[model samples]
Target: MWPIGRSFSSQNLFLCLVICQVVVCMLFVIYRNTQSLEHRLAILTSRWAAREDGFDFPEGPWNVTDSDVVRCSDLINGRFPSEAAINRTIDAIRETVIKDYEFIELTRDCTKFAWERGYYNKPITKEELDFPLAYTILMYRSVHQVEQLLRTIYRPQNIYCIHIDSKSPPLVHIGMERISRCFDNVFIASNLENVYWGTINIVKAERHCQKDLLNRTDVSNWKYLINLTGQEFPLKTNLEIVQILKEFKGQNDIRTLAQPVEEWTYYRHVLEGDTIRQTTLLKTEPPPDKVPVHKGPFFSALARQFVEFLQSDIADKWLEWFNDTKNADESFTQTLASYPNAPGGPGPIGSKAIISRDIVWSSERLRERRPCYGKFVRRVCVHSWRDLVRVSKSIRLFANKFHVEYDGLVLQCLEEAIHNKTHNPPMLTFHFIDDFSSSE
Candidate 1:
């Protein structure tokens, strides 16, 4: 009986030992899982914090804060900050949040304020008193940029025709209409075109604006017609532009290249269908028009006589011939400028006198001197703040491809510079005359 009792006690002790080992293993696993969960939670919290702070983000133009406005005002008033200081501020806000809805509402409110306050109304000086310049602005986006451009170049005597791309967002159309209604000199184009790059639609859009401007009987004071894009900013003041135009003395500034039509010009596009559209490139024969083919940049400033010629039968014939031609915008105007007997043709003034735009092509030389702000699209460089010094010193009346989102400082400084020049006209010194002559 004593031996049996001892065996039962031994078995009970072994069972207790096994149960203790199992409990210890289970506790270790629970502790490790808790630690892992805490680590995961910490990582998620850090990610959210980074996003909220806008770290590592490029600043957007519409992200202007009250402090930024104060700084800009200071700069305009000649409290110039060092380049490094400016860059630091810009970098700090580079990743500022962008809300599309807020941007649209801001545009509407600003337009209303400008209209009520007459912010753009200014007295015309003798230099531009009688000389009216016509402008056609082709815009697809950037409502704020457009408004800034209008305010900067505003003159009661000048007429502006804005053509919003038919494919643009509804907000863009609404903003443009509201802004145009504010001034008698500004009007939206009745005929809007769906513009495609390197397509005839661009030329058609310009022609529509020109025709609308010419048909308006309410205003008859315009003398020169300058075509512009939304990305272009005027480097010269209105008075300066007027003086330069007067120097031309009735000649047009249209660049042209007298050369045979390249093979690439023969490429054509075929649309798949009306609703679900797909474009297919097809190589076609050279333009049927027997006239010599010429190529040039799309932008120009033409005299009223030349603009009228574009509305004549001869211009219509060239337009029809180039309807199917690829990259017609580059050739249509050039062909007209090179045509015999045309107002801006190879006449007494010569084609060089007609060339005015300061376009920076994406050549090896340009890449070496001035690096592009953003990636090149279609081989064109988008101007950034880095190019501000070079562009400001340029002799051209206007520069192309400035994006507010890319670098707001360039445009901001440019506006201040222009305003300063206007308010305090420079003295007429011999050096000024020499600089003016060299620019011409």
Candidate 2:
């Protein structure tokens, strides 16, 4: 009887220990979860604060930045300062404009000259630093064609920060300088660095543009920012473009596009199918270390709010996911932007959401000719002038793939077609022809 009693007590003690351990684990988990939730909430608050005020400026959204004030000042001082003056006067009611925000619309050469003579090496911070303004940056290697488009097609109303790589020699800079002279709005960065292929140098160069813009927020009034390659040409006039953008105003839809998982897989298998084997592909598992996941470079845009989203903790988690993966730029942005449960939720899909445009190519065709330029252009350009006339009537924007030599005719024809009185406000006028057209 004694022996049996002792055994029962021992078993009870063992069960108690197990229960205690389980309870302790549960407590630890709860505490950790609470801590995590608090951290997330703090980050959300900071992001919201940053969004309301520009990044690094802690004031309310109503608090105006110095750079914004400068552009407004420049606009007020300009020939067409009515709108600019009104906007500036309204902003000045809140606070005086900072110096960095002042528009250096004098001339690209003059600005570059000033920069070379130690103008902006040290950024203006909020304290001793002026309210750093975001500069709007435009990057492209091929400028000759872009210059032609800017000169002949549509000149942007706002001054733009333009950079061409140093490899093109003094002639490119000279050409850009000439362009700058004609339009005070185009400022060229003279200190061009050699961009090494397949390295982060290109990315860093772009970031430099972003940093410059971020540092000097006064010159830029853009709530949404676009990163355009020199190859990218705008199909619409500035008035029409602004009109279309006005529709999306107030509604913050930060756009960051990514190839869908299926699309990513398609690229991966198409590139690696022969070596990867059918059986391995059929396994339906995550890619092994031996196989690289495929991703492509993107031409993307982001709203100011979306940029804040990138700075948030949510983006850190996203970075960790793609840190080791190749072609992470494509994967990270797309996945985070599309992830349903992500903070701030999924971003707008693409130009389709803004206005319908075709960019499709068959897998077989793409395989036969990787990155078909003419086909891409023809997707919108169509055959003959008649086809373009019919198609342009429906589509707001169109892009072409042919060399400038081949595609120049298409552009001229497009400009002429839109100029026709019958075209009504031009084909570009229909961009975002929704309920909001009357507002402009």
Candidate 3:
């Protein structure tokens, strides 16, 4: 028989175990509730802050609570928080070892939160508009910046094809996939290219996206194609863009110049493997078929008919001819645009047919100049806020080279301007050809 004191001690131990299990379960429930509350608070705060700052929130079914609004005012202000601050907040909840399920859940939840706060709301109505369907090719390295750009230019009527560089980190690929899944109109390109500046592969990457977009069952709906790097930003809203594109009246907006091809451009060069990092100059040879070489930058807003022509047998011949040429991207499209046999060729329209981009150069000339603003890497401009301010006054529908991490303020201000319709209200009034003809 056990002693009475020992019996009581054993009973007490069992009671303690029961109490501990209950406490642990209770704590877990509390933790989960707290997480849910925190997420709700973050969204509410973002929305309330936008409203308090005199910013116009898009009309939608936003999930906001009276208690949340009162609490949010204390936490959030009008200014956009820096990227670092956002990262810090996310890191607290995100595990160091990112599991796929966790990542997906996080992505879905964050996207939902942003939507609830009015970030993804449509500011315009969908109607029987004659606007050309916009086909966008977005090549990106920075996932966050790409997300911002996607959100800023999103329209239900448009189709977006995103291409992430093959060499980008794994996280970038995952993030892009998650973001792409959020919208039915958005998708990742089937083929990813390892891109290099001044290399043929750069042009190939664009072509890959174009082909992917063209192959879609709904390709017939898209009437215009705009190729943009991750760094580019829209200076006009969807309504304004549609209005400006309508002015083109089926004309292509590509830049082409009837200038002699530079010796470096035509010279035979061999790229080391698939990369442009190492190239060996081969013996110079005349361009195939003695095709007259025209020069232009890569940025373009092309008509569907012109893009269709590019997929034809004749374009295939030109592609083979320029396959060995240096800096092919700079000359390939220009040559095709000027080729008389090609459909929708420039013909008598000449430079008027080309209105691809507004580039600010150091010399302020069409040729023989580098970007005037931002640090030039590989001759392309990484534009700053000051440059954005100066270019904001121009009639260009889109502007090149904005790095959000470098200057988030510019993008934030531009977003505000676009949403508020403060910048260039006259653009909506249907101004004439002269307003848009100025060289960048």
Candidate 4:
């Protein structure tokens, strides 16, 4: 130390040193590496400026951190909430929700809307672009929530097939249509359904979207198909998703090998319109061709080949049989994967546990009495602020069941978390950072 302090001389005198960190956030977080100062400044300015200069230099979509916008960034990024802060958040959320302050009106102009929302115009990476995705999004209500979900998952390379329940009001359809018009890659399925819980229409709605996605020649190169409801949101960034999915190579992400619930298939059950209980009963037929039926969430990430199989004569027979079964959506795709002559490429090889689609069924955790601060919808938890801290470390890619009416703070926090990670990347501290630096 003493010797070095006396001399500042070097042979070239041109060498310079810079500091950087390999900041890794939990589970599948990916941030762009080593940006130029001008580029960083452009990102900082994109919030209001939303200019083409920023969109030209692609890394990820520009996002406004909803937490900072709502004043909850500190409390959610691992800091314990003070009582006053909690009360303040509560008051702000109540005020905003009652007045509907957070909602943004969407228009049909793709250029203006995209610039206003700061969608990534180009592919972030060659890897992500080549592995385009197709989404079968089932959304019945809440246009704002659906828009946020679309913004989070949207990429020009992917195609989205949105199915709005035919039972919803005209405003819901109008709102969805407005949003859909703003993106060429997104569209409403021609065949929509009057979906009801535990009813045939539930499965019919999703099948319709798969059929639509497959028919689209524009985004036909899409390799994977992920299904989602308006309430579900992605936990990982697009870049990270591409990485994880590429690792999968070709295997589908779904759960199987579940014990038979005879009541589900043996009896016909129908849920009344907008009602929680089933009032109808009739004899149900056994699965066609004696195929092995498996139980899992209807929401899944599938391969294109499997979706093709779903449209064939063989799958039509199964669909016809399942029309009378209770909650057939939960079993339809899973059963098809286990079928003897099904796609064969998507399954019978992957793990039984569902790693891609994540959901916390509050009903299953009753023995431990884990606190579900969020309200339960059809036995699934609608995420609340308390869930934010816990989900930050979840290994799963996408999480299900978020209701803005339930508690938007958690959604805001999550959106901000992903936003900050996408634009302003890692910091060495355990806390969140509004700064980024790296090398690819």
Candidate 5:
């Protein structure tokens, strides 16, 4: 009996040992799995933390911040689109395109495939985006198209201006109305005065536009002006334009003509000599607030303060001169803006100015008023696919006259140019706020 009991005890001890070994193995596995999961969680947390901060990005004309604007301008010049760009664009589309919505939106609306189908192969550099505006004018007499074009480019803020001669058809007014419907940030000339080629009318109209700009207090809040005509179109997508401008906003010197009124006289008169003759006439009444005198170009992005100056009392003499003078169109704004120490503060404000003077002049030398020396006579037409491609490459925010029927073409071109690759490249660096990881 003692031997049997001893055997049972030994057997029981062996069973207990086996059970303990199994438990140990299972515990080891559980511990390892928990450690592995913890490591994975830590890694994910670290990655998220890094992203909360930004990666180093390329500098200039790019920002993740919301409040930024970009400014670039080109005179209307008709240059065709590039083949390689079209192909790459189409390739990207094919890779991403799916479903009927994509077909209509990406293919039909954008017209990216049309160019890849070998429509025309004109090379367009970033520097050569001046043609669409010229073509839009020659084809369409509509001044409202300029506003549409500005919409395609992305800027934190935007203002568009359109200038039409008194000679422009009644449809011009209709076009202006159409523009008003589409864009709220546009300025259309309220006074439709006759613009004799060599007479003061052109300058008068320009002054009127400037006066409107100067009168506004809100316009100054903007960082840039597009100064476009009805015929111009955008080459870069709004996203791209916004990105580029955001990167370069404060850094670039492309502010509109917002120089203080006092500076205008000094630089224009003493330094540039754009104005040789200045007639100083004292106003007996000291006219109520300054009249807007000849400012350059119907379409310009004036700085807010500069515009205010144009509306100030200092601009009174200049405006009086513009309204009364005959050949003032030729030199009124230029002269008054440049006169040294003229009563007004230096006038033309802004970092740079681009003048678009592509109009066909008749053989009749402008004997009646000051002659326009360099006006391209051939009217512009943007009917064909080639025309659309060419105009899209212009990269100008504003353009001139387009026929009413060409609105579809203009809109299409504008949309495509905005979406192009070169216009919106990825930023080199990224940024994140501190405590992003710690809080999580």
Candidate 6:
């Protein structure tokens, strides 16, 4: 038993804490529920994923984060200035406009750039800082997209190696170089290759950057190397990416399938400078020393050790064999991922999520396959605003080919989502897998 005044004061304190908690809960509910009906519907509709048609590239159900749903809702709820206007006008804000590099270079201040353009300067988690990843990015076009993608993924702990195609506009190189000057970790490749599509130059460009990044002593402790194209955008925040890569446990997240070497190296491709012309249908010999041949996606998350393996003698012979091959970019990293002698090599077929990027290709026969709200460029789908809900919910680290010039709202909304997740992590995070298995 206590004195009457003391007991009363203790009860009063407990009651005040309960009142404070209740008020906080009520405020949260009101804030979340105040959005318009249409916004609520957008949130509700995101539960069911876009349908995947028959005979197309199949995938399982999408995983939606509650945190992403709120951000998507806010984009549609007119919380931001973009959504206050009509949809077309909102998206058009960034579609046709290019960044003014002259103005950017005037100050050349990182603090100003980060405040103005919203780059995440500090690491979100100790896990991300301790396990810094390296990036080898390919860029030829879309100045705004490249800059925004870099802004979103930029971190002090990580290193970035960008390879601007030698044939690209001078402004492209200038813009990238000026931006790179602001950061010690990001740089242009020592040797820029005149990248030609469906040729070995594409592979060489990546090799140049890989070598550059590997040689850097400042960030030599980086755990993995993630390859990206300028057009792609990250679906996950940097911290989330760090979390998923840890799931791979030491294995590289490369996708590969055993294929005949003749398939890609079948024709005698003549390269006069950057132009490629097939003169004769003569198949090249298989990989040297009977090393296995496999093919899959060009982009992947490779362990640092696997990158070291690539500099070895046998790997040199393997790369040389593909020098004259068509679309060798698609086979190089993937084929090397499954080699028995390769360090961190998981047996063939490593392309499972591992939370890396994705490319959507729709076949002509199944034209209405997985709905790409964005128009199809060549054969691959370039994502647009309508895909925001889907893209944000994906467990993958990033999704490729977002044409910001077409629908800038998608990128804006993704930015909002990442900003929200970075500042306030979700109450429950998706349990990422260690590797593909019976359950996946």
- In terms of TM-score, the best-performing candidate is 6
lDDT of 3 at 106: 58
Alpha carbon deviation, residue 66, candidate 2 (Å): 61
Superposed on all Cα atoms, the candidates' RMSDs to the truth, in angstroms, are: 26.8, 25.0, 18.5, 10.6, 18.6, 8.7
Q: Write one digit per residue (lDDT tens) for candidate 5, span 1-440.
A: 11224587777877777899999999999888755632422211111211111211112332122222211111112222344543344354344323222223323422343344222222333322321111111112433333334344423234444556666666655554443334344556556556554344565666566555444454444433334444545443333333333333232212123332432322222112322332343324432244333334344333344444445565566655444333444344344444344433332223233322222124435423323222333433333232332343332333443432322433444344344333433222221111211321
Q: Write the per-residue lDDT of candidate 2 for residues 80-116, one digit (tens) a residue.
A: 2243543444444324321221223323465574344
TM value for model 2: 0.45
Candidate 6 local lDDT, 1-440, one digit each (tens): 32235587788877777899999999998878754332322211112222221111124443433332223444332223333343555455665567646535733786687667766544366667888999999999866788889889988889999999998988888888888887789999999988888898888898898889999999999998999999888876787677667656667777665674564566667787767777667755757777666777787888888888878787788778888888888787767766767777852222343347656677635444446777888788888765654466665678878776677777777776777666754332232352223123
Per-candidate TM vs. native?
A: 0.71, 0.45, 0.69, 0.75, 0.40, 0.78
Top-lDDT structure, candidate number: 6
Better of 4 and 6 by TM-score: 6
Put down candidate 1 lDDT per residue, 158-243, tens digits, no spaces.
Answer: 88999999999887887788777767888999999988776678889999999999988766779888899998888767766776
Question: What TM-score number comes out for model 5?
Answer: 0.40
Instruction: Record all residue pairs in model 1 with backbone atoms less than 3 Å apart, i.e. clashing.
Output: 58-94, 59-94, 253-354, 254-354
lDDT of 1 at 215: 88
Q: What is the Cα-based TM-score of model 4? A: 0.75
Between candidates 1 and 2, the one scoring higher on TM-score is 1
| Whole-model Cα lDDT of every candidate shown, in order | 0.67, 0.39, 0.60, 0.66, 0.37, 0.70
lDDT-best of 3 and 4: 4
Candidate 1 off by > 4 Å: 1-84, 91-112, 115-118, 121-123, 271-289, 346-355, 364-375, 427-440
Query: lDDT per residue, candidate 4, 24-86, as tens digits?
Result: 332123333324332332222101222222211222322333342334344344443454565
State each candidate's clash count.
4, 17, 0, 1, 68, 1
